[model samples]
Target: MNTATASNFGVAASAGGPLLGDAEFQFLRDFVYRHCGIALSEQKRQLVQGRLLRRLRALGLKEFASYCELLRKDPAGELGELASAISTNVTSFFREMHHYDLLVEQLLPRWLEEKKGGGRLRIWSAGCATGEEPYALAMVLAEALERTGSKVDARILATDLSPQALEHACAGMYALDRMGGISDERRRRWFLRGEGRYEGYACVHQRLRELVAIQPLNLLHDWPMRGPFDAIFCRNVVIYFDKPTKQRLFDRYAGLLEPGGYLFLGHSESMHGLSDAFDLVGRTVYRKRVS
Candidate 1:
C-alpha cells in the first residue's frame, strides 16, 4: 500500500502481467538480506523487478510470486542466478591497475623472496567475476616465479557467487576486445589466440590455469578452505553490503588472513570503523595488524 509498491502495481497492471505485490517484495527483500547479506531497500524494488524480468522470461514464469516460490523451494540452487540477475558483474583484466602495479612491483617480489624453497603462497581473488582478475594475478605471479627462480608453491584461489561468472572464470576465455587492458606483450605471453570459427576470442594459457583454482562460493556462507591467505582481493564487492554485514565480513576476513597480510578493496570501499584488526596501509588497502 506504500507509494512505491502501489506505483509498481499500477505500472505492471497497465503492462498486463502479474505484479510483484508488497508481500512478495518484502519476502524477497528479507530473503536476499538474510541469505545473501545484501540489504535491498524499497528503492531497489523496481531495479530488482527490471533485472528479474529476464529471469522470469527465461524460466517461463508468468508471475513474480512464482519466482519467489521457486526461491523458497530451492534457495541454494538458484541463489547464484538470483544474485547474478540482481548485481552487475562489471570486471575486466587489470580493471584497477594500481593494485596490480603494487603486486608486480612490491607484493609478489616480497612474497616470493620470503616463501622461497618449498614455501606455499596463496592469493585469493575473492570476487573474481569472470577470470580476469585471477588471470591478471597469475600473469604477475608466474613472472615473479620465473624472475626469482623460486620453488615456492604459489597458487591463486578465485571465487564468486555467480554460477555464470564462475563458469566464465573456469573457461578462461575472452573476446579480443576484452584484452585491451592487457599489454601487447602480456597478450602474446599469456593467452592463446583462437582460430577459425573461434576467431576473435582468446583463452588464457595453461600455466595460468595451473596457477588458479576456480570455485563457486557465496561469501555470506561458510568458506571451505581454512586459509592464512597472504592477500585477498575483494575489490568492488562489499559496496552492496550493509554496515553490520560489512563488519561481519571484515571480521571474518581478518580471521582468515595472516598477521600483516594484505586485503585490497575497491577504491570506493573503506574499512574505517568496521574492524580494528587492520590498519589502512594504502588506498582502500588494509594490512592485518601484526598483533
Candidate 2:
C-alpha cells in the first residue's frame, strides 16, 4: 500500500465507509494469488478496495477486516463472489483478428491434412471469458473445414475461473450491440436474432453451441481433461499472473498440447524467460517443439 492508496481508502472510509487497510489488502492479495494465481500489484490496491466495497456492503459488513475474516471462514462460498468482483472478463468476437486469420489460412489447413487419415481436432480456449473467443474459434474452424471439404470431427473446450462467467458463457446470449465486430454474413450464419420479448439479444446458433463445451476451471488447479490439443487460445489471460506462475502454466500447456500444436497468447504476453518448450512461430504465437 502506498500513500495514494492509503489516501484513497481514507477518503472512502470518511465518506463511503469501510476502509481497506494495508494489512487487509495484503491478506486479500495473498489469498487471491494463492487461490487463482492472479498477482495483484500495489497499484491495484485502490481497484481491489473499490471492487470489494460492494461485497462488504452486500454482506452488511462495516469493516474490510471483518470481510476478510468472513472470507476465511467460508472460503468456498465467498471465493466465487470475490473472484467475480476482482477478475477482468473483457472479451469480444474475433478479437485479435490476425490469430483467426492465421488459424483460417495456415494452421487449420495443415492440421486437417495431418489428421486426415482419421483423428479428432481439438482446441482449448483457456480463460474463455463469456464464451466469445471459443465461439469465434468454432465459427472459424467450421468455416475452414467446410471450405477445405474435410470431414474430421472438431470440438472446443472453453474454460474459465469464474463460475458466474461460465454460466453466462453457457447461456450463449449476447446483446445485439455486442455483435458489432461480427460481419453481417457471420451474424446471420451463426446467431439467432431475438424476437418479441427476447428483442435486443442474439443467441449463438445450436450448431456452434454444439461444438463448444463450457466449464468452470481455475487454471492454478489440476485440470481433469486429458488433452493433446491441436491448438490453444489462451490470449490475454496470463497477464494477470506472476512469472513463476506463468512458467508453470506454460509448462503445463506444453504438456497438454500435441507436438507442433499452436499456442496463441495475448499481444502483450510472451514465453520469453518462462518456458523453453515452445518456439515462436508468429506474432504472439508459439508452436510446441517435438521431443
Candidate 3:
C-alpha cells in the first residue's frame, strides 16, 4: 500500500471508535454482509467504524442499532444510500496492470486456439467500482480480438452493490489525474478528453464504453447474471468477508464459472482453505476445474 492509503486507513481507524460501540459494530457487520456479501472480520472493526462514522452522525441516531432500524424502515433510496455511504469504492485505471497483461499475452491466445465449442466469451467484474477494471478488460479484449481475427463475441458484466458506484460506472467519466499509470496512447485511443466546464477530466469512448454493462448487484444476494464466464475478476472485494462467507462465496463463484474458467482475486486474498473446486493458477488466479 502507498503512504496515502496507509494514512487513510490509520485515520479511519482512529476516527471510528466513538461512533460505533461493540454491539453497533457487530450490527453493522451483519447488515453489510446481509446486503452485500461482504463478511466483516474482527480486524475490520476499526475500518468499519472509521468509514461509517459520517453515516452514524448524519442519521441523527446515537446508536448503531437505531441507525440500522432507520435504514430498514427507510422507504426511499435509504438502504441503498446507506450501502453507498459505507462502502469503499477506490479504484484507478489499470490499477493491477499485471492481471490484464496476463490476460492479453497469455490467456486470450490459449483460449482462442484451444476452445472449440463456445465462440462466446464472458467476463464478470464483480464489485467493479466506477468501471475501471471492466473498461481495461474491454480494451484488452478488443486488442486481442483484433489480432486473432476470431469472431467470438465478448461482453463485460460490471456489477457493484452500491447504487452511487454503479451510477459512476455507467457514466464512464474519470479525472485525468486518476489515469496516472495509464499510457498516453491508450488515453488517446479509448478516452475522450473533457471540455468546457468539465475540462481536466476524461470519459471512455462510446465503443469501449459499450462493451461493459453496469448494474447494481449485491453479491451477498442472489446473482442475477447466469454466467459460465471465461474469466471473473472479483479482486479486492472479498478481503472483508469472514471465512465461512468466503468459502461459500468461492463455491458460488465456482458454480458460475465454466469448467476451466479463471478466477482472479485480490493480491492480499488467498484460496488456501476456501474451496477444493478450483486449481491454483498462480498469483491469486484460480481455475475452476471441470468436475
Among these predictions, the greatest TM-score belongs to: 1
- Please say which candidate is ahead in lDDT: 1 or 2: 1
Q: How well does candidate 1 match the true structure in TM-score terms?
A: 0.95
The TM-scores of all predictions, comma-separated, are 0.95, 0.92, 0.84
- Which candidate, 2 or 3, would have the higher lDDT against the true structure? 2
Candidate 3 Cα deviation (angstroms), residue 24: 4.0
Q: Residues 86-105, candidate 1: write the lDDT tens digits.
A: 88899889987988888889
* Best-to-worst TM-score order: 1, 2, 3
lDDT by residue for model 3 (44-141), tens: 77666655667677766565567767756762356566667666777877877788888988998877766535577889999898888889888888
Whole-model lDDT per candidate? 0.90, 0.89, 0.79
| Candidate number achieving the greatest lDDT relative to the actual structure | 1
In candidate 1, residue 137 scores what lDDT?
A: 92
Give the distance in Å from residue 134's predicted Cα in candidate 3 to where it truly belongs.
Answer: 0.6
Model 1's lDDT to the true fold? 0.90
RMSD of each: 2.0, 2.6, 6.2
- Model 3: weakest 10-residue lDDT segment is 8-17
Local distance difference test, candidate 2: 0.89
* Cα lDDT for residue 54, candidate 3: 71
